[model samples]
Target: MRENLTSVSSLNMAFTDSMKPTDLSADKKGIKRKNWRRRIGFLLKTNSSQPILRLVKNRSYRPSVDDVNQWAQSLDKLLGHKYGKAAFHIFLKSEFCEENIEFWTACEDFKKLTSRKDLVSKANSIHEEFIRSEAAKEINLDFHTKNAIVQSLHAPTPTSFLAAQKKVYSLMENNSYPRFINSDLYKELCAAAKGEGKHIKS
Candidate 1:
């Protein structure tokens, strides 16, 4: 994998054998391949080189995770190897993943876009930070934990608190609780307007 990437990098863009950009780049987040020719480079029917590395082919620009998936699928058709499929997915997690919303929408995209279980926990942490940040637009957590907090605020009973704890447990089932509540969780709690239901004087 390293050799092919390096070899492709060393090849001049004008080289007769170098791949034409049909529609991909390592940085592009939302673009798809068919419309990519106008944006990046030409997609070709044949790999720019042969035998230097038979395992993979890439584009002039750094190929994005989406492109890698397509290329890997192409190779899968040619080689009939399951490893080829596995490697492509692993590459997607590494290449497309980001610590901030600027790169990825949420940590969930990392999993939805790729099939790497090894990445879920780490990605979940980063996603938790992103959720807590002011810039975040989406919130992700289990519904149970969220409702427990809401119900506790509305009807403060020991039973409710236990239910809330159980809900929190549900959200944090596999991992430790985060240091801070996410913006989405906060908003949900605030939206309940528990105290607004009645007026009280200090």
Candidate 2:
């Protein structure tokens, strides 16, 4: 939902107008356009919790051709992956923007992550970091758990499901999850996991 780069579109032109070579503001700042064809590109980072809110450093996050493809694929994966979409729906409520190219920043920082066909590998990195932080009590009970569920969106087996279950249970145990678990999205996932008809909000 949150964008790391500003997409330039004219009122009279197609959205296909590529993102111009301009410094994506990490915050509120002026813009200077550059010749994109000559610019070297780096990558923008995202993860499980606020995956849509990618934070790119000034002049550092220029995206590689492959990374751009992967990031776009990541967006699609979030929409299709059950748990990822579910959790991200909630994130969207808090972060979605009208324009796809608005400058955005994630709520968390990542030290290292892997590259997957889409954003799955990046999401896994965030998930493992959250679990580690929670185990060490480095993160508060709320965020630690929320991110864990987001990671479970890529669940391919029972192990990943159980991992998400552990975090959800911890939330219930601490009595800090009423807002999160009671949401329409969470309940939808809960029902679908139980083989009920309702999985997505109508």
Best by lDDT: 2
Per-residue lDDT of model 2, residues 1-202, tens digit only: 2222333222111111223233345531222112111111111112222222233323222223343233234444333343333343332222221011110111112212233333455445435543345432123335655655565647422243244444443433334233434444333333444445221221
- The digit string of per-residue lDDT tens for model 1 on 157-195 reads 223223333333343322221211222222222222232
Task: List the lowest-lDDT window of 10 residues for candidate 2.
Answer: 98-107
lDDT of 1 at 84: 26
Instruction: Give the Cα RMSD of candidate 1.
Output: 22.3
Candidate 1: Cα lDDT at 111: 34
Residue pairs with backbone atoms closer than 3 Å in model 1 (clashes): 21-41, 21-42, 22-41, 22-42, 22-43, 23-36
Candidate 1 worst ten-residue window by lDDT: 33-42
The lDDT values for all models are 0.29, 0.31
Using TM-score as the measure, which candidate wins? 2
Clashes of each: 6, 4
The reply for model 2, stretches above 4 Å from the true place, is 1-109, 113-177, 198-202
